[model samples]
Every structure is written in structure tokens, then in C-alpha cells.
Target chain A: MSFSPLIVRLMETLRCLPGVGPKSAQRMAMHLLERDREGALALAETLQAAMEGVGRCKRCRTLTETELCAICSSHTRDQRLLCVVETPADVLAIEQAGSYRGYYFVLMGHLSPIDGIGPNDIGAPELLRLLDEIEAEEVILATNPTVEGEATAHYLADQVRRRGLKVSRIAHGVPLGGELEYVDGGTLAHAFAGRREVTA
Target chain B: MSFSPLIVRLMETLRCLPGVGPKSAQRMAMHLLERDREGALALAETLQAAMEGVGRCKRCRTLTETELCAICSSHTRDQRLLCVVETPADVLAIEQAGSYRGYYFVLMGHLSPIDGIGPNDIGAPELLRLLDEIEAEEVILATNPTVEGEATAHYLADQVRRRGLKVSRIAHGVPLGGELEYVDGGTLAHAFAGRREVTA
Candidate 1:
């Protein structure tokens, strides 16, 4: 008749995920009890482990087991080519591509002054301070293609330029194999404006 | 960079959730490591507990911690009246209504000979035996409005009739306040078929 408070709390906690509502949470909870018991346990254990010990990498602000992340600890990674991103999820997305061997700087958020988010909120101030600490010759702004993403990229570019460092923003617009007719006008324009000649 | 097999395996395991893909699985895995460690551990504990001990009640076949379900065990419930359903989730739905005080008989599934499931697959035989043991006075069939649900209800009605017991199926068709003109053909037919005699 009654679920233990702990069970209800776990279901409530799961609702924090994107697109999950009460019905989905209930289904997920029932599923955990019915089918994926081991997986549920593993998730719980992982959460516990991360919450108690995990913290942001002091250098790049990526979620890490230690103060410094694996990228920062590794000597083989291309430290001179630093890729900056909005969140940890963004870092994972870039990593999935498996082409960029550069180290990373995770901002965790972006500048949104209207929503009360500022440079400090997204760790921009801290990132600027880290630039002097790390000898990265080039920085890539790999923020999303949204207006907020563009503004943040431009702001970062200006700050890095003032610091006398080379700053480049990741190309945004129409994707490869995309039809111009189907593409959003804004993205197409950005793509054309940022177009570069193909190199052999 | 390549993730350790343990990490990848955990991510794969977590991806079994309905909407969780590989990327969401990775984020969730990472989240488990970053936050709510104790809660995660508690979830694992509950999973193990449910997996180890929870099972169907001998009476209604609904999930229970004991041989008898909570609904069956409750002395306050109307034992003389029984509600038949296709799944335990249906039982939960009725319970949440707070109007249905009768005991339940969960079919667990409906007849699907093509999928290899039959009458016995969903504890129909067990239900048959339990009906005699309980000596219930009235049985209300509350299966879904689907073809399988209807077929299952008919099968139950036939089985109960042979024993000379009172059995009735729940009404099918358009929802409350639904426009007849807007209703689907199948629903309209069912609504017509289940229509009760009106006194003029």
C-alpha cells in the first residue's frame, strides 16, 4: 500500500533528468524493481561514489576523481591545443568524435546575464586565470551554435586576444551533407560567413 | 581516450532504460559517480532486496512481499467482490483511484498465441483455481480495451460461467465527455455494443 520514503525519494531524484515526468519516473522505478535490478544497484553505487568523492578538475573544471583530470595528468595529450566546451555533456560529445587529441577546458555553463548567469557562473573568470597557468598556444571555442553560445564564444575570444593568445571558434552552421533548403537560414548564413577554402 | 572496460560495461548496462541511449547512459553513470552516492547505494540495496524476495501473491498474482498481496490481506477490503485485470500496473491504477475497495486477480498478461503466450502464461490457471478457493460472489472484469484484453475477458467469462458464477466485463468505448462524432469506429462500435438499456 505504501512505498518506503527512500524508494519515493529515489524516484523523485530521477525526475531531475531532462524530459522525465512523474509518470516516467514511476515507470522507471517499477522497471528497476521488475527487470533491471543489477543495473539499478550499479547506478545507485555509482551515484554514491561520485557524490562523495568526485569534484571538478581544478585546472579544466571537468568532473574528476582527483583535483586534476586525466587529461591534465597525461603528458601525451596535445596541451597546446585546448578545446573549450559548455558542460561535461559537451565534453563527452567531443570525445565521442575521437579525432581531437587536444586537452579540454569545461566551463560547465555559459554567460547568460539576462538569466542572472555571468562569467563567474560559468567559470569564465577562473578559465582566464588558468590561461596564464597553462602554456596553451591555441584555444578553440567549441560552444553550441545558439545565440548564447556565440556570445560566449565571442566574449572568450576577445578576452583571450587581450591576453595576447591565439583564439579560434569552432565552425558552426550547416552540417556536412546538409541541404541548404532544409537548413535554418541563420545557420546557413553563419556557415557562409565563416567559410574557409578547402585545403589538400 | 579509451574508457576502462568496467566503465564501459556499466554504461552499457545503464543504457537498458527506455529512453537512455549510450550518451545518456554515460552521463548517468558519471552522475552516479558525482552526486547522490548514498541515494544510489540505497537504490542498489532496494534493487537487491526486491530481486531477492519480492514475488507475485498466491491469490491475485500481483507483486507482493508475502504469499498474499496487500489487497488480498487487507480485512477491510470487500472480499466478496473481485476485480480482474491484465497486469499489476492495472491494479496500481485502480488502487490510486481510491474508489475500488475490492480484491483483484491479475492476469499478468493476455492471450497471444502468436507470441507463444497462452492462458497459462499469465497465471490464468492459477486464477481459475483461486476463484474456487476464495468463493467470491461477484467478479468484475477490468481488462484493457485492446483486442487481447477483450478476448481475455471473454475467456474468463466463459470459464466462470461453466462454474455458474456471476461475471461481467467493464464497459469499453469513448471516454467521459468524449464526442461520439469524434470517436474512432472501433471505440464507437464497442460503445454501442456495451450500451445499457435506457428507461424512457
Candidate 2:
């Protein structure tokens, strides 16, 4: 016999999560039912609030409940140095690195022609508008190193240069603390090609 | 900078599920916000309903939205042969095998003295009462083969035997279709000790 209808429904609904499968769904359902009913209810409330209330920041397009995300509204950040990235998660990653003082423009995705995602779909026009409005001096393209990311970066770089603004793509090479022996061939070649002369 | 307050709260709440960690929680939150708001809302509603509606079946203690679980209420099931299991997931496993026709008594957990879990915590007394009420001719101990599970099975077996009912434990040996070379030493020993004679 199958589980109770509600239990079955809960398990099925749980599969919407990225990595959860049938077994993991079942285990999560059972765990919630058995041990953490309060936490389950709290999670439900939080999920509902987030889905309905969280909206993109009007300026940067990162997720926020307010009209402007905290980064876009802050006066202390270097607004003239805007970093464009693929997703809001990338914004978080750079912030956690704790070095960058610039504001961000979240593309939310890259241009994927095979999937019919074009400039408008990734808010390229909005980004151009923001660049003109903010008159940023330097724009850093921090999209991932994938082919689509590179293509998107190049497209945005051309647009920024046409507006007479400096545009630079993030470096791609062997990662810091990564050993050369285990580095992939493509990355090793890129590292060699982009090698900088040592300056003391 | 951290994520939006609601996004941060959602990620923290998502960690209540089994096997989810900080990184997975963040990914789930971003995925739901970015791609699947409908699924996130549906999952929230289902989680709320399940947490509030599902309760233990009065007869067998398995999770159910009603007073009795489907197995406990079914007339076709062999009420005279009862299977005792440590958790509702165990009951699901046996039912999926599609061979056992007996009804089940779910303990929800096994006896673990070090964790301060005793007979009452696992509903051992309720199981004994069920045995008296059902007058089952045979009781199957389907608890896992772990030390605590074995102790619980022996304890329950003694109680059933005192009531003059036949009690048997499920077999422990090399699993069906498992290679002998890959089987562990404990299982190999158990298989050899429990070997049956050929009757051809």
C-alpha cells in the first residue's frame, strides 16, 4: 500500500527542489512528520513569504523585497565601478570574497540562443540603460568561464566600449592554491597565455 | 553582503529538511526564486497541509491523515499475522516488496538506551496491547539487523511468547543477488550458520 495521500503529495512536491529525488523526498517527508513539525511549518511560512514578496531590485535586478536591493541603495559603494554578473548568487560570492567595493548588475542568465534567450531576456537593455544613467567609469564582466558566459561577456563588452566606457572581463586561469599538476589542460594553457611579468 | 533578508530566511528554513546543508539550502532558495516560483508555492502549501493534517494511526501508529492507516483498516490484509517494524519507512519497504499480506505495527523508532529512548518511547507497550487485542497467531519481527533493532525484536518476541503467540525474526544473511566475494565477513558468517539443507 502507498503512503497516506497527504504524505504522498508532500513527497512529490518536495521533488521540485534541485537535488532531491524520490528517496530523499520520502526521507525528508518522514523526518518532518516525525521530528520537526514546527520547523516544517516555519519553512512553509518562509517559503510562501519569499515566493510572493521577494522581487528583483529595480536597478541591479538582484532579488530583494524592497524596490532597490541593499547594494543598489547604499551610498558607500563605488557606483562608478559596476560589476555585471550572471546571477544574484554570483553577487553573493563576490561580496563574500570581501574585496570588491563596486555595485552589481545581475543578468540573471546568459544569452543562450539554443534556448531562445536573447539580450532582452537577460536584461542587457536594462544594463545599458543603467550604465548610461550611472556613467560608470569601469565595468567588470564577472560571468562564469563557460562558452555562453564568455560570449555574453564579449557582447556586453562591445556595447560598453561603444558608449566610451572601459570594460574588462574577469581573469580565467588556474585557481589560486590549485596545483599545476592537477590543473586542467585548457586552464593551464589559458594561464600561460595570460601570464603577467613579475614586478617587485 | 548577505542575501536579501527574506532570501536569507528562506535558505535557513530550507535546511530543516534531511540532508540539506548551507550550500544546498542557498542553491534551493535561488533555484526556487529564479526558476520555479510556482513549484515553491505548491511545495509550501503541501508542506503546511501535511504538517498540520497528518497524525499517527491509532491502531498501528503509522503516520496517516485518518484515525487508522490504510493497512490497519484494510479487511483483505492478514490481521492474524502481524509484522512489527521500527519505522513507517520500514513498513513502506515491506509493502513495496509486494509479498507480505500481514498488517504492520510501526514503532517509529527502536530502543536506544544511551539516547534515553526506552520501551514507551517506541510504543512497545502499545504493540503488546495490539497483540492481545488482535489475537494474532504469528508475529514477525521485521526490525533492522542493527544491535538496537535486534534487542528490540528480542524484547518484543519475549512479550509475544508470554502471551502464547508465535514470534519469528526476519533472516539476516547475504542479500539475494549479492556477490559472495563482495559480502562482508559478518554476513558471510551469518549465511553459513543459517545454511539450509538441500531436499531435492
Candidate 3:
């Protein structure tokens, strides 16, 4: 009786993604039916699979299908060179660069005082535990250049300095107010390769 | 174990909507969770319910929960004045304008020649059959101003004239290249009320 029950149900489910509104949801539903039903279905499957399968690595908070992330579990990666980021999306952004063989540690969020989100809310304690567990020679701050991201980086740098481990920040290839995802992969790779040590 | 599976899936669906891209989808998905999860959920439920419930009216191509659409079956509506449109969404847009008290006949699509769509493909035959079923003084063409929409209207008008029925086109209040859905409700309502008869 229904023209498109599965398609409609899928659109309803997709309305849960961050920026989608009702009108947008309707257009998306129509597009799914009209143009790219396969891609829509793929996206749906990815969502369900990611929801069911993807989890944070126990060691570094990177997205993983298992106990540890692929980067963290890989023996080929440099355990000594650890990069820190604000989210899993940022981790993916970095991975696209494809030059750095260093592992990453995701903060999962940044410190935002106005929003009442602090280090405790973003797994800073767990980060410290991760740092202690790994034999890292240098920790790179790959958080964004936003105010909250900067504060998170500063806070993280101070913590690692107290632990007597060498700390570094990613070079300023990223704009002050820009997001990591929007940046070109080559620029991000170059920034990673040209990171500067933060000794104080 | 997951913080937001529904939200992630919904964002994916939002991507298929008209204006939403990846970044916007992310923002929308986050907004739903952060600002109003219940409202978002209500919207989702409505989408599912409407998808499952709404069907083509047997009498008109307008969407209905029953065999006959509300306009077709309603005793209060003017049966003598029937309006024709291209899609179910167009029907909703016209209804929201609050001017037309007449019945509707939705074609579900316009005639697209290059894409191989024709009069028979988009329910034109069904509409021709409905002409005999309903006793109407005039049938107003409310299809969009697009070339394909124009062609379809012309085709329908010719068919209605052959049967010795009065056929008229909705006036050109909207821009030449504009869509009915994008026009303001008041403008569309006024246009419907002030509709003039087709000369050619």
C-alpha cells in the first residue's frame, strides 16, 4: 500500500544526523528514491554498522572496530610519536594525509568553559592514563586552532610537561578559525611532518 | 554502548535531502540531540507514520489515508471547481495557502521528453478517465511554469477541450522559472483565487 516504506523509515532514521531539518529530510528522502537509492542505503548501512561495530580504542580513543585502533595495534607505526586530536573525524582527516606513521590519541572533545565542558568531560584523565601506558617519546597536539581547542592543547601540553615527556604542537598549516575536515589532505600531511617541539 | 546511533543514521538520511551536505548534516544531527531530541524524535515518528499511511487518492492523485482524498470526498468543497497539479507536495503547498476550496487532481509528474516520460507515464490517462467521473464546471491547470509542466498542461487542456469541458490554466503570479513550493503561501493562495481562464 505504501509507496516507499523502507526509504521513508531510513529518512526518518537519518533525521537524527546533526544539521538535518524537516524540509531537508524530505528532500533527502526524495533524492534517495529518485537519484541514489544505493548510496542512501550504503550510508544507512554504514550508520548501523558504525553504531554497532565502531568503538574507541582502549589505548588512544581513536575509532576502532576492535579493542585497539588499527594505528595503535599496528607494529609498523611509531609508538614514540603520538598525535592528539579533538574527535574521531579529526583522526580520519589526519589519516587521509597518509605520510605520518605516528599513532594518535583522541581527546573526544575540547575544553569549552561557556558550554560547561571541561577536561574531565573530554577524557583528559584517560588521556593521561593512555600516555603513561604507552612508551611515547613525543606527544603532538593536533587539536584545532579554535579558542577551546587552543585551551585544550595548552592544558594537555602542561600535563605532559609535568610528566617529563617531550611535547610538540602541529605547525600552523590550519587557519585560526578553520576546521580540520575542511583543510586539504596534503597541507595537513605537511603540517604533521613539520611539527615543532614545545619545551618550556 | 553507543552515545547516538539514531542521530548518526538520521544525519546520513539528511544528506539525501535538498540542500544538506556533509557539514550541514553533522550540524543538524548534533542540534537534534543537543537542543531537542524529543522534537526530532516526533518529527521522525511523523515521517515514518506519514510514509506508511499516506497513499494516492483513488479519485485524485493527491495523497490520502483513504481511497478518496479529503478534497474529493468533502461535501463542503466546491465540486464544480477542480484544480490540477504535478505532485502530492504541490497539493500540500496549495492546501496550506488556504484559498482553494475545490477538489484536486495530481499528475504525480510532468511530461519529460528527453527522459522518455510522456502523457501516459505520469497518470494523464487516469486524469482523462477521472474527467468522466467528476461533474466539474472548470478544471484549473496548477502545474508549474517549467517547459515540461507547460507541455503537460497543454496536453491536458487539449484532452479536456475534446470532451467539451471547460479548462483553464492557473495565472502566472509566480516567476517564469519558479516552483509552486518555493512561492510564499499567501502569494500562491492569491494566485489560486485570482486565476483567469486560458485563451489559447
For each candidate, the DockQ is: 0.25, 0.81, 0.20
Q: If you assessed candidate 2 against the hidden native complex, which CAPRI class would it receive?
A: high
Backbone clashes in model 1, listed as residue pairs: A41-B44, A44-B40, A46-B32, A47-B32, A47-B37, A48-B37, A50-B33, A50-B34, A51-B34
Q: Where is the poorest 10-residue window by lDDT in model 1 chain B? A: B191-200
Per-residue lDDT tens digits for candidate 3, residues A76-149, read: 88878888898766776787778777888887778998989888987889878878888888989999988888
Among all windows of 10 consecutive residues in model 3 chain A, the one with the lowest summed lDDT is A1-10
Question: Candidate 3: what lDDT?
Answer: 0.73
Q: Rank the models by lDDT, top first.
A: 2, 3, 1
Q: Write the per-residue lDDT of candidate 2 for residues A1-200, one digit (tens) a residue.
A: 78999999999999999999998998899999999999999999999999999999999999999999999989999877888888888777667656678899999998999999999999999999998899588888777667788789888888888888877765566565432233454554454345332211
Off by over 4 Å in 3: A1-15, A29-46, B1-15, B19-53
- Residue-wise lDDT of candidate 3 within B1-200, one digit each (tens)? 22234445656775655677777766665455434555555555544555556566788865555777656767888888888998766777888778888888888778998999988877888888887887888999999999988899898898888878888887788778888767888888778777776655
Note the clash tally of each candidate.
9, 0, 20
Model 2 ranges with Cα > 4 A deviation: A174-200, B174-200
* TM-scores, each model vs. reference: 0.72, 0.88, 0.83
Model 2 per-residue lDDT at A71: 93
| Best by the lDDT measure | 2
lDDT of 2 by residue, B112-170 (tens): 99999999999988988988788688887767777788788878877778888777766
